[model samples]
Target: MAKQQVISPLPGTFYRKSAPDQPSYKEEGDQVAVGETIGLVEVMKSFHEIKSDFAGTVTKFLIDNEDAVMAGQALVEIDG
Candidate 1:
């Protein structure tokens, strides 16, 4: 298996859950499909879903929830 990285497409604050009380979209060891939403990035009062580019098991999250991120920043790692 090879490790694939999920990157942030825009600069924003990354959120693991849709809302404070909601469960995270994904977590470490979770199965992730291609085009699946792993998280959300909020910018300029708008939120965008961050999708996975590869199908695999989520190996780890590179940053914490609600953390500020930059475009092209690695958000998650997957093994496929």
Candidate 2:
């Protein structure tokens, strides 16, 4: 299995859920495809939908929810 780098498109805080009490968009081992909404990033009070760019299982999540992230930072690792 090859590891596909899933990078953040913009600088923001990465979140795993739509809300604090809600379930994460996904978890490890979940299968995802390109264009699928995987998470959300909040920047300047705006919420941006974070999507998968590859089809595969979620091998890992490189960034923690609510963590400040930079543009081009790896957020998720997909086995594509």
Residue-by-residue lDDT tens digits, candidate 2, 10-37: 9999999999999999999999999998
Q: What is candidate 1's local distance difference test score?
A: 0.96
Measure candidate 1: CA RMSD.
0.5
Q: lDDT, candidate 1, residue 74?
A: 100
Q: In model 1, what are the clashing residue pairs, if there are any?
A: none
Best by lDDT: 1
Off by over 4 Å in 1: none
